[model samples]
Target: MVVACCFGMIEVVCVEAKDIQSAGLGPVTLAIDSGSCTGLTGPSGSGKTRLLRCLADLDCHEGDVSLNGASRESFTPPEWRTQVGLLPAESFWWSERVLDHFPYKQKPELDSLDLSPVVFEQPLRQLSSGQRQRLALLRLLANQPKVLLLDEPTANLDQDNIMRVEALIAAYRNQHRCCVIWVTHDRAQLERVADRSLTMANGRLDGDSS
Candidate 1:
């Protein structure tokens, strides 16, 4: 719970979780600094996705999570989600039309993900899996979230698209000072994007690498 106090404002840790306990994971503690990316990697079924769900408050868990020094309790579930956006392995779309899922008159930086604006006019069913994945990220970013919980966001993309997605997220982190917890199995991707990386195994975190 260490935090810097300056002029009655706390601008130190961007995200903090204490003793987080959830399905496939338990009693985990970690902190993410503002405007930095932290990579979490491990074998399949190592509880990475559950950890992200717990942090996003989408899964039942025993823990304390806070953003910008404000406890998650301070906001309702929906409100908290707006600040802590989660991009799941597979994104869900409620509307058949691509544009319906996004904010009206709001143009996402589509080019950053190698998407043309015309794609927005197409039907959701017409989009490829990779295209949908990219659009889902853009939709999440449209909220300008302070924290991003990404679960293998580039898994469906090719190498070029992977680079594009990484660059886009890096740019967002730089421009908005967004805190990120990127869960991936790609060691190469981890090295490229993470300021520091941690390994999770058997419901615990260890093996710190920078």
Candidate 2:
């Protein structure tokens, strides 16, 4: 299904996975609509991250995933991943300087996260955990992905920064009409951001009862 919005035509099922199964996770099915946020919460090692990886095609798993009605098999791994971006808890930095990783000039989004322009000049090694987490989110948004798979995106931030990140993601989704699948342990945070919430247990999504 599709819908017309300010961002143009958006697929209701922007992301769909049928029978997705990984080593630790059971066969799972999920459908996420554009401009909506779905919260996924589970105990540690319950395969929440694995499910996100499967959706991003970052790991080998059974079943199929489609984005915008296009099957994952139709595109190259890199091409598919560009449309369905995953922001892991611990972000990896390849270059020494931060600016080298970004192709275009910085935008005001940085300031919204309370990040200074000088942060672009700093080396990756010098950044704190929270800094890396916030910068990682910025990097993901720069890609202009249709779907976002976030795993504990605000784990390292304080309450103030957490709200900042949540607002930034909400604003971005509203503007782009993108789909968001956020995995977090905080129930209150889930309520704040997710249009619908689901709980995972023993590697399977149990219910939206949360």
Positional deviation of residue 99's Cα in model 1 after best superposition, in angstroms: 1.5
**After TM-score superposition, what is the CA distance of residue 161 in candidate 1 from its true location, in Å?**
0.9
Where does candidate 2 clash, by residue pair? none
The global C-alpha lDDT for each of the candidates, from Candidate 1 onward, is: 0.90, 0.88
- How does candidate 2 score on lDDT? 0.88
RMSD after Cα superposition, model 1: 2.9
Question: For model 2, what is the error of residue 180's alpha carbon versus the real structure, in angstroms, after optimal superposition?
Answer: 0.4
Candidate 1, run of 10 with poorest lDDT: 1-10
Give lDDT tens digits, candidate 1, residues 76-166. Answer: 9998998999999998999887777777847777888899888868888889999999999999999889999999999999999999999
Residues 84-134 of candidate 2: C-alpha lDDT, one tens digit per residue: 999998999888878766647555368879888777777888888898889
Q: Considering only N, C-alpha and C atoms within 3 Å, which residue pairs clash in candidate 1? A: none
What shift in Å separates residue 63 of candidate 2 from its native position after superposition? 0.4
